[model samples]
Target chain A: MSKPETPPAPSCSQLFWVFTRIALTSFGGGVSGWLLREFVQNRKWMTQEEFLNGLSISQALPGVNVKNMAVWIGYRLLGWRGAIVGFVGIIVPPAIIIVLLGTIFSSLSRYALTHVALTGAAAAAVGLSLSMGITAARAVPRKAVPIAIMAGTFIAVALLHWPLFWVVLAAGLVSVAYAYARAS
Target chain B: MSEIPHTSLLLSLLAVFAPLSLVTIGGGQSAIADINRQVVDVQWLSQAQFVDAFAISRMAPGPGSLLVTLIGWQVAGFWGAVVATLAIFGPTTFLIYAVAHMWSRNGGARWKRALETGLRPVAAGMILASTYVLLQAIDGGWFARAVALASTATLLLTKVNPLLLIGAGVVIFVGLHAISLA
Candidate 1:
């Protein structure tokens, strides 16, 4: 039997521009989900299984999922050139926005209207964050161990006001132990 | 008020982003609690100011980490914003590029998979922890709690874009402000 051939990789320039569009337009939150839908599901830039695998790896790495995805996808597409293009695409739009907002916000600082708008924005941000938390919690493998870790950590930090570092360290140790116990 | 010297502004921007870039091993957003501890509690910026920058960053497009630029802007000015933006992204970008290059050449190794498996839970826990911290900081009144709850519900129930929610909140705030003025 003949072996199936791996599909041709996307060109560096194509990957660069596609990621650029994602970076420029992905507003408000869950950019990673949006990215997956667009690049993997819709465009078939990657298969769904590959995207999920990429996501798992991206989340496990030490960067924003979107940025990490960009890097991984870039590397997958055209090696190093693709990676650079993806990184630039990811950062450039936000940099521009920040610069412009920085200029405008300073000039508008003393305005009462500005403060009112900001207050509303803050309220919305809190809501958005809460929503993000719920979505993320839903994604954790629905197992007793992970759930317990989640609940315990939430209580430890939210109710008891433990330092963040300690909460993270404690959760990490517990998770590792749980995994170890399960394996053996 | 005088403009901060360009050099000092640049130095401060670097000061903020350089450490954040390195320590943010998992991404800039994950470093938020740490950033808040260092900036807000340490008096680099006030709590309200941090909240303001964060809100603005979320409202706008692109990465959440870009809030560092707003903080820089508040501390200094235009030049500071530019420098801070570059400082924050520049090093991280370079590092990611180099790492990607190496990973690609290595023909997809098992070490990468191991690293991913380890970091997954840690990143998730960090996000959960950050959420809790933010909740504590922002929880004050019924209105705030209500808004948060409503937003969360909307996010969970529908595919409505967050910008719409943010815009609606702005409108509500303005309306409330107008009523109070009256």
Candidate 2:
């Protein structure tokens, strides 16, 4: 299939810096949203439909959605080097910051307020997790089998204290198989 | 814990995170429960330390899965962080990259749709379960739980900045602490 290429891809360094800025500037959630704005809205690197297609695949596949989206976008534009640049740019800088923060907090671990502040932050962080859970739950189809699988997964992992690996494997296989059968 | 050799510690980090990488269906958040379980079992981090790492990861920018990196740093410093980060993120990079190559092709549309829709329920369940585990793991009493619930409500109901919510949480707790001290 011959494809027309218009406008050259950004240099690998440019791609790296773009991803780095996105990663460093993103606070709280919504990294994917930032990706959409930068790539589709501002840069016009890809169309909205193309980005959304990558977004869905990114979400469905195992891995972090934002990171997957980065790789997908990078690959779409610049091939292998772009993908590698995207992955490293998004992951490395903030990783160093996390370590630094962890060091600073560990030093202050002796203070009573340190624990208290962390506790507060953690409490709020749980909301982040819970909100994501609720959103995911709402997206599930309103049907019996899928709902049952979801409930069962919750039970096995949370209540029963079963190993998450086995629980995810079993539930995922069953659910995917069902969906596949239905689609046939 | 100190008696464990350096190479073994790195290897252990790999063993724990690499497998969990592929199974992280929805996101890195989905694997937290297992990460918590394994880290605790190995005595790499106490529950409190794990929770602290979780909070720090939340507060830090970039991917939340960097929680694994923080865990590694806490456990064995720089080398630990390096191993853990690579383990958690590396496996899935290959998986997603390969998929991206094939995704442009028109074949296997039905299977692709099935995989996407089928995984949604399981991902939802895992995320909720992880939330349940975290809610239980937190050390703060009712007040903390209340704050978490309030944050969740706020997030769902409004488009407020989560950083603001977290700051409010800190102020509320510290302020209440000051009153109790007085």
Candidate 3:
């Protein structure tokens, strides 16, 4: 059964505050999931398909995925202004806090324990990062060229220590060329 | 570079971070190694201080790329932070905005598909590479490595919150330190 009614659009401030709240509350990462729950499930502001589509585009494009996603959702719901709200909501509040924390950490730099706690936190955060990589890797199609590009990229950047600009540019050219040929 | 006037330093931060923003695909992790390199090359911060900033960014809320904000503050002051933040985040904002606009209006064009499909592998590769670099740079030796691996597993397999895992890591390291001292 097709649904007959679409939900009314949320105001720009409503959009901004939601993003700001998510930015403020999301600790230790997983912001994308939070976004999905808020827009797709909780408020029904955006459909699941729309959210997923925006997510894929955000992931594939340059720039921060969350910021892109925020803009994507905001633009869809409201327009240009909504997009700006999304950007500010997701970034500004947290930027302020991180700077404050940095200030405190600088003064507390003498303590060995501060560094130790930071190290521990950093290590555990790797779990979040690696898990994300695995998820992305699994999304690649089962084919030789894509797999090769992925592996080549890792080697160039990680093992070989090639500069990222060159690696991404070179590998992206090859990968996109291959996709273009395959498409035709 | 440090001796440059305030406005100039702010511009340089904007310059450094703006281009890096375009390369920060796949959740911003892919850009960290390059960002570290740029920060080092520019003499904005020392390697040790950069790592410290990275740690602080990870520990703080919001995007990990906030490391630049921390970097700016360390190098200059309040406006430095604002400028660095804008530099890192502003240019790319236009990009995604344009893409978002076109996507909704046109609805799944061929080039769009090509771009998304083409970039996926590169994004994946970059994430893996950045993860490796981070692994090499973090502290606590084997214990740190173990926690990272275990945390990875838990995240992949379970629904536990990441903050809890990071807190547990801090507690474990502190406990280990106390035992070694005794």
lDDT per residue (tens digit) for residues A30-119 in model 3: 888999999988899878888999998888888888888898899999888899999999999999999899989988889887777778
Residue B81 displacement in candidate 2 (angstroms): 0.4
Ranking by DockQ: 2, 3, 1
lDDT of 2 by residue, A9-110 (tens): 688998999999999887778888899998888887887888999999899999988788899999999999989999999999999999999999999999
Q: Top DockQ: which candidate number?
A: 2
| Residue B130 local lDDT, model 3 | 81
TM-score of each model's B chain?
0.82, 0.95, 0.89
Cα lDDT of model 1 by residue, A20-75, tens digit: 78877888767788778877767676667666766666665445667777877776
User: Over the stretch B1-182, how does candidate 1's per-residue lDDT look in tens digits?
Assistant: 35656686578568766655543434455566666766775476778677767778877788787887777676776676667767666665565566655753575545554454434455555566666566555523567667767887888899898889888888888888799899
> What are the runs in model 2 whose C-alpha is more than 4 Å off?
A1-5, B1-5
> Which of the predicted structures, 1 or 2, would earn the higher DockQ when compared with the native?
2
Error of 3 at B137 (Å): 1.3
Chain A TM-score (model 3) = 0.91
Candidate 1 structure lDDT = 0.68
Model 3 TM: 0.93
